[model samples]
Target chain A: MSIEIQNLSYTYDPKAKFKKIALKDVSLSVEDGDFLAIVGHTGSGKSTLVTHLNGLTKVQSGKIIVDGIDLTGKFDAKKLRSKVGMVFQYPEYQLFAETVQLDVAFGPKNLGLDEEEINVRVKDAIEAVGLDFEQIKDKSPFELSGGQMRRVAIAGVIAMRPEILVLDEPTAGLDPKGKRDIMELVLSLKNTLKTVKTVIMISHNMDEVARYCNKVALLKDGELVGVYTPAQLFEDDTVEKCGLKLPTTVRLARVLKARGLIENDCLLTEEEIVAEIAKGGRHA
Target chain B: MREISLGQYYPTGSLIHKLDPRTKLLITIAYIVMIFFIDTFVGFGLVFIGLMATVLISKIPVTKILKSLKAIIFLLVFTVLMTLLFYGGDKSEVVLSWWIFTFYKQQLIDCGLIACRLFFMVLGPTMLTFTTTPVQLTDGMQSLLKPLALIKVPVHLLAIIMSITLRFIPSLSEETDKIINAQKSRCADFESGNIFKRAKAMIPILIPLLTSSIRRAEELACAMDSRCFKDAKNRTRMNKLKFGWFDPVCLILFCALFFVVLWLKFNFLPFVDLTSLGWIV
Candidate 1:
């Protein structure tokens, strides 16, 4: 298992007049190399749950055993963080260094990595994000376009070389093309990097999750509604009751199936939906 | 994360809220002056009664005022102590003695008067904040200080800066909270280190915070520029503050009080005058 959360519960200001239950009795496990997508509305506790993965938030009354180690115990958290890199929402907002290279070097430098290793990692990270090294390496982060700066921010986290990469709304404000490019880069990294064992992301875009995520965790008002394979969760009638959208491809598949043009249960991606339609065309 | 309550500005419908901010500001100033003009304990007593009446009319909870008082308790204690130790009088005689410390009778009286005066000074004007929004206060201040532009000072710029900084306080606080959460996720323990270790631990938090602040500032500057901040030169007020008859009436009362205090300064009243007791020495 890449990550295992057992009987997890957390509350904010538990004894205060305005105590809030941010998380409750959520138990789940992620397999190695699994791509997990968590979906929830604002304040639904998705942020709180993801923060717990890297030990950002302590499990007040539950266990978060990551990579076979009990993270609930007090340990060298900084070292643990290096193994679980987090690229935050609006990451461009954190770019403060004078140049892109320096900003990307920040996390690695914080790890106390020597100059040679840091340089090698920065080069690989920049290249992996499809950014031209020489052109952008020395430019001030403020000087880049929004999408470019966002990618550079991602590269900064990537340079830290974590086995499990966690992204919080990585494409939040990007244009459609920018979003596609970022998603593609993420998929490529997951496919090629053997040591990159788990990828967890929080997103509201159902279509994006349906296309890429193998496992989905649905959170509602800080409680784990269900954890299931994407197909099982989407096909369940209760999903819409929680104010969630059916994935775009799944919706289309349902529409096609209703019109008697498709016979299979459902599809979760544009390609699968189209392939199913092509199969129907031969039958017609 | 919690100590920053912008200002009192208690949201309520009351006679104080109905008063023009300019009027409230003027009256608060006048009230402080009037408080100082009270010569004897009777006059001081009258001032206290008047302030209490105003507080009642404002309809603000007395507990709220007491909360403000609680914040300034240390300052109040220090002021009273200094008055007792330093103030002297001609007829001053030791009321109590403990080792090297002497409590002179005249000094005791001075201490009581000064402490009450300081309390009234804080309490009187605090009503302005408790009644008026910070925006109104800044607007009042800008209008009052408009003539200072004759000295080439950028009054408008100062107002914009004040308003923007006030607006960003809550925003920056929330941002700092998020960044702290982000760092903590990585096992950065902030709460359990020595002074030096804690300060060192803050580096990870501060770097991201400072970086984000600068980035946001730049974005804000860009947004302001696009919104024609360049034409910021001759911008008219969205809500101009107009002085009414109430404002002049309040100003006159304060001017009268100021003159009375000045008069008392030269022609001191015997009961309130500690000079005869040689308290000034």
Candidate 2:
């Protein structure tokens, strides 16, 4: 299923004196199977836009048809949420159940699933997040490490078997190894959960964006600056103009190309840069 | 929740906002005490004028200050109703009589006076909060009650707790919003169903909010401990409270107004004589 957003605009406390226009008139669409990266400077309406995709925030002045569900009026939020699972920033703080199994079962239980289906979904989801279900399912979620707690929180959302998975800075406040592991886990989640057809992530790490994301949607001042492929986004000066830093791989690739060290059209990842150099130096 | 501007700080950076919190605290206490001293209509009128002038000087929008009174609307109406209906007036001055309640000119005037008093009462506190941050407020309270420390009160600890409580108000409200939204995305129905169902729905929001709040408190304790908070008995504040030039001038002005109000209270004759009814000595 695809999502289409049309002319979305949101203002907080519209009648108050200090009303804030959060999102302006913007239009975009995401097709299924696309691993989309939403990158913007802080308060660029990335979170606001993603919240609307799952009916977390009400539609103030826009039309969002998320996976054939119109979120403009009295649509079923339960159905929409089951289609789009949101893993918020520092999601571990949202964990509250006594055991890891219970926490992972919270969403499916809310979906009104029966006992056997919930058990199956909970076990699958817990295992899908790379946690040992047999060993840690009965353990208190609070007793887990920070990264494990975060995984349990994500498992709670994944148990709903949503067709689309949305993450807002999934690796925030993590160590370097933890960060890599979580991103790789998200990649694995896409493979393990056939129901999850699309992944939308809001992140500041341009290296992760360059490495995993197929399409990048840049937002500036609540306005969409056209969706572009990872290669196309890094090929121009748009990322810099939007007050975002480039990935180290893309920067090195650009510097090498400028000095006539490599003859490559567009290089996004370190492996792409390495492969381009292996083909031969431009001076060679 | 952020949209509720009632009793929240409004940063206008006006002259009133610059006054020392201790001075503001003292003057607020005095103003509240003085509200009961004046019984005359003219005196209440003067108090109204004084409160409005201070509100104007605060640079807060007049409507925003009025908005704070919305919390006490029911009380205001009840007070006005009681004063109007229960006034025992002269046998000849009845303005309207309906059912068991009789309204008189004196009662109508008393109703107006009571409403004005209640209106200004809410406005006075609202003005303080709008002009002062919560940190400044607790600091002011701690400084004013420093004398209690000599009697073995845990003054510094009390102040720190109060300060943290104030600091967490906005953050906790923000976290509540996030948790509610997160639960809503999990197909948690917080708005529908019977009362029991709705109350039960709050579990998802409250548990996360409570846990995070406790976690934050623990983290803050650790951070404070690492910074040698235990040895902070002689700790100096960076934004030390000092009486600026406005403090003395303001004190004098307030004193003058207070004496004038006291003079008006004792010297003026009321329209109704409670002494004749033996309610006063």
In terms of lDDT, which candidate is strongest?
2
Give one digit per residue, the lDDT tens place, for model 1 in B1-281.
Answer: 33345777887787667667877776776676577665455456656666776788789999989898886789889989877767657445778899988777777777778778778878887878898988888878777778998998998898888888888888888888777765554345678768998897787667768877776789999999998786345778778777666566656655655665554456565566645645333
Per-residue lDDT over A1-284 for candidate 2, one digit per residue giving the tens place of the 0 to 100 score: 99999999998779887878778998989998989999999988899999999987889997989878989999887888999999999999998877889878889999999999999999999889998999999999889999999999999999999999999999999998999999999998887779899999999999999989999999998889889998889887899999999888878877887787787746777788888887756347
Q: Weakest 10 consecutive residues, lDDT, candidate 2 chain A?
A: A275-284
The fraction of reference interface contacts (C-alpha pairs within 8 A across chains A and B) present in each candidate is 0.30, 0.70
What is the C-alpha lDDT profile of model 2 across B135-227, one tens digit per residue? 888888988988998998888888878877877878888898888878777888877899999998788788889999998999999999898
Give each model's clash number. 10, 0
Q: Which stretches of candidate 2 lie over 4 Å from their true place?
A: A11-21, A251-284, B1-6, B10-20, B36-46, B52-63, B76-123, B148-161, B228-281
| Least accurate 10 contiguous residues by lDDT in model 1 chain A | A235-244
Best by DockQ: 2
Give the Cα lDDT of each candidate: 0.79, 0.86
